[model samples]
Target chain A: MKRNGITIGLIILLIGTAVTAAGIGAMHISPQQVIAILLKQINIHIPVTYDEGMANVLWQIRLPRVIAAILIGSGLAVAGAAMQGLFRNPMADPTLIGISFGASFFAVLTIVVLSSLPFMNGALIPKYYLLNVTTFAGACFTSFVVFRLSKTGGRSLITTLLLSGLAINALCRALTDLVTYVANDEQLRSATYWTMGSLGGVTWSSVWALLPFILVPIILLPRLAKSLNVFALGEQEAAYLGVKVKRLKAVIVVLTTLLVGASVAIAGVIGFVGLIVPHMLRSITGSDHRSLLPNCALLGATLLTMADVVSRTIIAPAELPIGIVTAVIGTPIFVVLLVKQKKQLRLMS
Target chain B: MIITAQNISYSVGQKPILHNLSFAMHPGEVTVVLGPNGAGKSTLLRILSGEQAPSSGTILLNDKSIQTFSLTQLARCRAVLSQQYMLNLPFCCEEIVMMGRYPHFNNHPAAIDRDIVQQCMQEMQVAQFTGRLYQTLSGGEQQRVQMARVLAQLREANAGDVTGKLLLLDEPTASLDCLHQQACLQKARDLAQHGYTVAVILHDLNLAAQFADKIILLKNGQLVKEGSMREVLQPDCIADAYEMEVEVWQHPDYNFPVLVPAEHKVRSILKTSNKNNIHEYNSRSFVKG
Candidate 1:
């Protein structure tokens, strides 16, 4: 009953935040105007007074960006939650473990290398698809390597895992920087803006294109919540309780790669939504993954939408990077979590 | 169910852990595996639980080769409680207990699953803290919760008969206190009486004497003896397995035998003892049991 209440509350909060965020931009649309515009588009005509261009701005600029934020935010959070459960470590996150960097690295590499190729002139293989495929590969590769390196004996040493993540993040960051060094002017501008991770680039077409990739994982990961809950019992213990451990791990890697990879491909590298959202919700929901996962999706979407709104309005004329806003808030929380659990971390070692 | 391990041998690379051991665990009997450290008791239990495959042998569960059974099939009948659990997530005890019911349900747990989890938690005496996070429990309390979880795993919805189920426990009493240790072994004994095939790996010789209907004594990864408690818990067999001298005495108020370390050697050594003689006594001076 409590889980249901939390779920319903988060859903309502998400809708409220999305509407409010949609109304927030340089050319402001009121909340009532935003609702009227949304309802009118859905064929529910309502009498309201609003500027003709205000409706255009809401539809063309703000709404897609908000929807994109919701999709990417939920995608990253669910992936992070599943990774934390899969690794049996609370500190696991896509950004922390270099998955986002890996995706960004391959994405930049594709733009720099394939953009000038001879066959790239025509749509032999769409550049968008080629970029996504390479980014997914990158995410999967880094995740597998980090996981394999961090496991000593049968247990995952938490210190080793997190340290290895740091190492991989450094390596991917260096490689991404190298790719950016050689890019053309327009490509460089896009890549640089993407690396900072803004929702500024999302269009109706791009949102539709990114939809299936992100939606597949966001929809499917929750179905594995029961198995992931069993996974918290350790790998061998989970197996003893009849979970197909190998298959579950494989599916998680693929789904999370698809999730983080697609989101990074779209939004560059948004950090900490994956980490802090799940971490906060776990305190409220107690890490059951059934309630934890759905609540993560709803709250993650709400928080990132609100963050985007703040990023837009805080500087007014020029906007801050969405990643910068998240990082500013997330860094202190991350440090606080680390400081509070210093003893627990030592005990784990 | 009768689980027969035929010519079981296990090795990690060139180092063998178990070698050419054959045994059968029967329903309605508490068979305890006893030996010193590194005797491969946990390894043997793991193999029998179908978590690990023997290097050169086959395990037959009721005349069917264990490899033929899927993981879900084996899990429905057999549950293992290993010595170390690597869980640190702050899931509540009820949620942790519900994990044992994973194999029996698809997505949502049914009423019968909840009932069984409740009953098992009550039986293991962990129901009082069902809402507490599992990570916050004491070591012994955690062990009891884990015990309840495995019990919930093998529990059938129909409640009474447990004929084909197998429960394997490795060093279950390591973190437990005196009363809980006895309570844990007593619960295994009770489950055995209810027709579950119960096998445990224990380091305590006296606890084995008190609860084990049958004993499998192992030494250097080889079985030294396998028989009833009276036949297998003798001083010589235990001393051969552990390489320590012991005196077997009949308990004054009980029918079971009690093993006491022979202090006569220590007394004599102390009587005339220099540091050199004390070292000699510990090294090789005592008579082999």
Candidate 2:
């Protein structure tokens, strides 16, 4: 009952933020006018006043960016929750484990190298699909490599998992830098913008492209909430309690890869949203994934949209990177949590 | 239900853990597997619980092959309490116990499931800690909560039909206090009295003597003896299995055998060190004077 109330409250918060954020940029439309414009699209006329310029900005630019923020935020967060549960470690996140770096490396390669190939211009597939597909492949590959590297005698040790994450993160970052060093002026600017993460480039096509990857995982992940709870006991114990541990691991790996890959391909590497959102929700919801997952979706969307609003307006005419804001906020909280986690682990042992 | 193992053998890569072990765990009895470290007792329990398949042989539960039962179906009838649990999340004690009923429900648990969870927590004396975080509890408290979890798993067979229910506990009392250790084994005895087949692995021979209706002694990945307590808890059988001398005595107030390590044969050896100082050490027979 308490979980339901929180869920409903988060939904209202998310809607409130999205509508208000839509009206904050350039033309400054009011919340009432935002709704009026939305209703007008559905063929319902309202008495409120809005010009063609404001409507175009609201419809084409602001709405897609806001929706993209929601999807990307929700995707990264749900994937983080699932990954942490699967690994049975609170510190596990898609970005922390180098999955985002892998996607970024592949996406950068497509932008700089693949698009420049003479045959690529005449290829049947667009660069957009090619980049997304390769990014997804890279994410899947890196996650599996990390998983395989950490597993010893059928069990994955937390120490080895984090160590491997560090190694892979460094390796992918080096490779992305190498690609960036060789890029032309135009490609370099795009790659630089991508690494910092922004929803400014998002359009209707990008939102549509991201929908299946984000929405499918959000809907399907909660279905495994019961099993994930059992998973908290330990992998072997979960199997003893009737969860097919192998199948569960495979499903989480694939689903989280899809989610993180899509988010990275669309908005570049947005770190810490995945890690922080779920960590905050776990304290309130008490780590029951049934509540934790859905709450993560709603709260993650609201928080990221709010962050986007702050990034857009904080510097005025010149926008700040959303990743910088999240990092500045997330780093202190993450360090404090890490210190607390170390104490908890010491107490447990 | 009677779980029968036929010539079960298990190996990991090139090293074998269990060799041609055959046994049947009958309902209404407490069967204890006793062995020293690395004696394959844990592997045997894993095989019987269907967590691992034997390298060669088969296990039958209720006259049907274990492989035929789906994971969910197996969970409804059989529950296992392993030696180590990796739960670091801040789940309430009731939530941890409620996980036992995951197989019995979908999405949300029913009222009966909640009732069983509460009843099991009460049985394990952890009802008062229902809202406390599991990670904040002591090791013994966590073990008791896990005990309640497994009890809730098999609570469906608690009332009328008790057949086909089996409980496997691997060192369930390892982290418990002395009083709780006895209480835990007593709870297993009570479950056996109510028609649940209980199989436990215990390192304490005296505790096994007091609670086990039947005992299986394993040595070097093979069964050394399988019979009643008196037949399997003999001094020679235990000494041979553990490579230590022991004596069995009758309990003063109970009808169970009491085990004491033989200490009378200890010999003190004195040796001159390089510095010309004398060093004295007792042999392995030195338990207590």
Candidate 3:
């Protein structure tokens, strides 16, 4: 109950950020109008009325993006926490080891590599949905392969995970380079856009499709907090403490892949939120997965939603890419965190 | 129910770690495993804890194969504390201790789990540091904290089932101060006296002499000696297994065999060899404590 206080605070902050984010973008709506439209769409009819145009902008345009932002932010953060826990390394993140880019690579492969081979066909996916499909495939496949390589002596070894992660990362980079070598300008442009990361192009379908990933992590990862806690004692220590470590490894691999894969797909490979949010929350919430996982998800949602709000509104009508906003905001904060966390890093490693 | 490890042979690639080692741990005694580094003390501990299976042997617990016991059942019967735990997260000391209660929590942490944790912390003398970050603690303090965690895990096992309860620790006192080291091993000794099967791997032959009821000496992954401490800690056996001459004597206070490393023999041998040319060897770091 005491630990839940931090989680509850983060939840409140996320809700406030989500609400405020909905009112941002080119077509400005009052916070009240945003809430009314959202409530009406969800069948909670509000007494307050608003224009249909505002409803279109709120329900159809801005709402999907906001939901996706929240989902992706939390998804990435939770995935990062799980990865860090799985490896027992604080420095572990989806982006650093290239799990985030794994998804981006798949998207590139689908768009650039797969489409180029003879008899491969003109398109792997429809032009509109190309980014989402490819990225998701990339994230899932790379993570699965990398984690499977983590097995040593019938147990998952952190060294194996790190080494395999490096191998997959290099393979993805090489393949992506090859893809770039043969791509036409339009294909390169799209590939480049996806790789640089963005929260743009989030349709209602994108929101709905990512719901399973977002929800699965939020629900499932917290349940694994205790197991992850034991795992922090090292894999053998976890087993000694009665943790089903081999099974826990599989669950961690699956959950992390689902969360990171879906988030990368929805948001085009945003970085740092996964790394920074969990590290920061661990400092506050104290690495108890029970508290840290949910709290990371909440803070992640709030931070990224706020970043999206800034990305759209900082330049007003002309928008900065959401990925750039997070990177800009995230990198400086990450440096500060790493500096503050230096002692812990040194001692543990 | 005792653990019977027979003809246990473990190897990695072409290098053998443990070779045809056979041992049976009886229920009411403390077994201390001692050897030089890389002599497979940790490998043997890992095998007994079921963290690893012997490459070419069988380990039976209570006459049943070790693998036959589910992790939950195995956890209830035994707990292990390894030499080092790499932790980067800034977990509070209490939370770190609470991780020991994980197996007992079942679906959720029951009310009594906190009491168990608190008792173990007090027993380990780490109750005062419960609020600090584990990373902020001194190495000795952290080791004690983890000892508390392992002790808490053992506390969860059924006390009435003495033979079924086992505690395995590997160099648990390696980072501890002398006082804490005695306290930690004394706790294990007390637990063993209460009929729990206890096994430990320790580098300090002196501590093993003081507290270990049964001493199993290993060298080159083979069992060189096994018996009561007095029987196994003979000067010749100690010299052979450890590659150091030790003068064994009964402790005046505790009446246990005390192994005094023959530091004089080494210096005397060096002096005889290089009486006039001892300048270079004497100035080197090896001869100092």
- Mark the regions of model 2 whose C-alpha exceeds 4 Å error after superposition: A118-125, B264-289
True contacts kept of 1: 0.67
lDDT of 2 by residue, A61-94 (tens): 8999999999998888899999999988888888
**Which candidate should be chosen as best, given lDDT against the real structure?**
2
After TM-score superposition, the amount by which residue A255's alpha carbon in candidate 1 deviates from its true location, in angstroms, is 0.3
lDDT for residue A262 in candidate 1, whole number 0-100: 86
List TM-scores for all candidates, in order: 0.94, 0.94, 0.89
lDDT of each: 0.86, 0.87, 0.80
Label model 2 with its docking quality class. medium
Error of 3 at A104 (Å): 0.6
Q: Please give the DockQ score of every candidate, comma-separated.
A: 0.57, 0.66, 0.53
Model 2: residue A200 alpha-carbon error in angstroms: 1.8
Tens-digit lDDT track of model 1 for A18-43: 99999887888888899998888779
RMSD of 2: 5.6
Q: Which residue window of length 10 is worst by lDDT in model 1 chain A?
A: A121-130
- TM-score result, candidate 3: 0.89
Model 3: per-residue lDDT, tens digit, A228-323? 988887888888878888799788877887787777666667888888998888767688888788888889889888888887788877777777
lDDT tens digits, residue span B116-224, model 2: 9999999999999978999999999999999999999998834676777899999999999999999899999999988899999999998998999999999879999
